[model samples]
Target: MVTLELKGLHRVRSKGRVYWYAWRGGPRVLGEPGTPEFVASYNQAIDSVTTPDNSRFRSLVALYKASPDYKKLAHSTRRNWGPWLDRIADHFGELRIAQFDRPERIRPIIRQWRAKYAEKPRTADYGMQVLSRVLSYAVDPLGKIASNPCEGIKQIYNHSDNDRSEIIWTDGDIAHLKKTCSVEIAHAIDLAAHTGLRAGDLLRLSWSHVGEDAIVIPTGKSGRRREAIIPLYQELRDVLARIPKRSPVILTHSKKGPWAPGSLTKAFDTAKEEAWSKGDNLHFHDLRGTAATKFYLAGLTAREIAEIMAWEENTVERIIRRYVGRGAAIKEKIRRLNEVRSRT
Candidate 1:
């Protein structure tokens, strides 16, 4: 007889033969002790009982982080997801997965979160989205939860009928920012307006990416290998030429080597207040839309603009239509009518 020390292994005699079983997970029949089959069955029973415990939300998040899907996310995305995940874990980490099996329980939590962040509906919605994905992962592969509780939860930031919060920067606004802000802030704004790169991408840009005639982006927001090339516009060239390359990065603060996102934002907020008396509801990202409008007005096709901006052609077209299409179309129509009248 082979002695096994595995817990939950019980023996029963049936038909004058020995049978071994693992408790809770049911029977694993090995004919007799000291045989190869018996050893294999014993090992299998041990494996069944030693599965990792992921019965809590916190453990499920740890498993999700280890999953290929999470690992494959862009670095920026993973960085952004950390705080959202931390928030969710802080609030509900100790709760059993079964506690959130119903949508009713999830709805009230979302409502409270929404109310807490009532001023920033977009943030609330994004946090909710992160929580929803975590719950979904728990339900499917982890099988800890019976269902996702976040299903059918309405987003508080859905402003379908209202105008978008992001407004484009005008020529006057640009000029005003350049005049009032520091040289570094002015250059950052000009670069954004000319390049249409996101704040993160702009900050990550290195001197190596800049060439005589163009800027090369090896990796962008998509986290793919696609390279984006933007030609060096004359005005942008002037701005770049004036700044001495202090670090490997093209942009940096005088003291701080590279601008942190929060510091950059706060600096922009102060600059905006000094530049505009009315405090225009413009974000640094709005400079991207401003650049897209400028590109469209300069007669670049949506496909060409898409390549330059590292966006889909459809996205380029939609942004153009939203920002400059109506005005550009009306101006062209009036000019054509005037020419026809003059010829007649």
Candidate 2:
């Protein structure tokens, strides 16, 4: 039951049962540790010449994946991290984990691996993040190493104002994209713009979640750590009413079934390509900020927007500053200034 407490132990779950190994691809231990059979199998596996010469990374990856920590990741986070975990195994599978104890020895290896994606700084940073997590798990719960070589490794990607990340969808952009996308996807875009929900949360939104005066649900990004109660403003309600409630899940695919993340993304990309010959490269996520701006203009304070969007007040402030045009901001400021002058 507690076999994981031992070093090099790997666990696999299938059909509601767990099987134990001395190390992944090393030797299959028959039963729980401390049993005579388990002890014998484990000792034999550790000592056997037939046991393949192995890098512990694969086994470590297996152990980490089996943990509750990995299981609890946001659906999107797990989806993104999965491919990187596979890549980590493929790239670093040959290295013995004991080498990590000497930070000087392993730092160059991580750096060299990271160097391959220098042109794509974000991708490089993400890969290192997954790799570093695996190594850290190996150090603590697995007891395989004393330290993570990835500790203090600097990330190359830095946020900047000039980045395309600041670009938001204009009304014209929305109209063009809606014209190109399927009715369902267009409806999804409208919902995202109104409620500022992530694509995953948007797809999962349903009739039961719609209350008399609000759309209430936990967000996918926070993994249910927070709930967003979006007031049923006429604008958001109007967008919701445009889509029919045929499925328990909103945002169906190909006129039926739930919209999976991949299918939805593919449809969105196709729409973007068809919508513009050379358009602004904005993501669906940018619509969140668009919604934030909408809320700010409608007299919702930053704290209110933060609560409804399940975002930080600081983030709400940034979005209000970023997405609201300069002229609009100045005009709004003047309007507020006049209101105070009238009061005085």
Candidate 3:
């Protein structure tokens, strides 16, 4: 006989003939295992719309919560999927693992979401992918569900035929921005352009990460500790020299703590306003793209760029194609032109 108790929720025990259940809300049942009566009653109680305290489901939930991987997963997942998770949770009204274990229920939810996102089909599809992943945790050894129902659902993404252009800072744009922005923001921008660190990584950058002619980030996005050597160019060093030791952040603002989210955008907006130019549609991320482009143009292979950027070689290619499109793409275009010239 096995007994299960969820703190502040409910209790259940297996006896010789049947399973006994008790809960705070209001429910009691006893039925022999493998009987229709037992399964029906269990399912009904677990599916309660108001304050459900089903012990069977809680067992699985507890295991997932207790996992050592949970904290690291939460941090990384929130960083990437926080916005989407909030939206899904709002629509589902705090769904439990058992509720989402069936393919029929998941299919309807996905269809409903697709209808809701008819205008932006791509984002709607991405929401479904996020939900699928959350539900997949139920299949772990300690979980209640035997399998993930979301395994078979096909995804549809809406992408445009034309590639999105990246904002490339020309020498003149760099000069103007450097002169216009405060020394702190200007240095941050320079570092961003040269190092290709993501905006989040750049905000977390500290003197501790800097070493002899190198920047070593022990925890990169790919879950690897990668060290990239930065040439101690006079221009980069000059930018680094202007920081105020009083500020903990590399990019000093009046407020305490690191650069605020969208800090670069605010500075860019000011620079655009001052220069009487429509600001580049590029984000702070475009700086990473710009750096990768320069690296590629310098005849570095994708593998070499991956090492510097702490990305997989394929990821390096994707970034180059999406952001720079300056290497083989340019050569291919020129080749097509030459072919036309020969034909003429």
Superposing all C-alpha atoms, what RMSD in Å does each candidate have to the true structure? 7.7, 9.7, 9.1
TM-score of each: 0.64, 0.69, 0.63
Between prediction 2 and prediction 3, which has the larger lDDT? Answer: 2
Pull out the clashing pairs in model 1.
none
The collision pairs in model 2 are none
Considering every candidate listed, which one attains the maximal TM-score? 2
Once superposed on the true structure, which residue ranges of model 1 sit more than 4 Å away at CA?
A: 1-60, 74-76, 86-120, 135-152, 160-166, 223-226, 254-261, 313-344
Ranking by lDDT: 2, 1, 3
Query: Per-residue CA lDDT of candidate 2, range 1-344, in tens?
Result: 34345678887899998788888887789966678888788878877753434455666777778888788788778989999998887887767767777899889988999999999998999999998898888888778888888999988998673454346677888998877678988888899889888777887888899999999999888877788899999988888888887899877877578987667877887788888767557877788767766776677777898899888666777756776555556766787899999999
| Candidate 1 lDDT, 171-256, residue by residue in tens | 88889788879878877888888888888788878889999889988555777556678988887788688777888888888674
**For model 1, how big is the CA root-mean-square deviation?**
7.7
Q: Please give, for residues 152-242, the per-residue lDDT of candidate 3 as tens digits.
A: 7765663554345555665566777777666666667788887778766777678767667767664446444454545555655776776
lDDT of 1 at 340: 91
* Cα-based lDDT for every prediction: 0.76, 0.80, 0.63
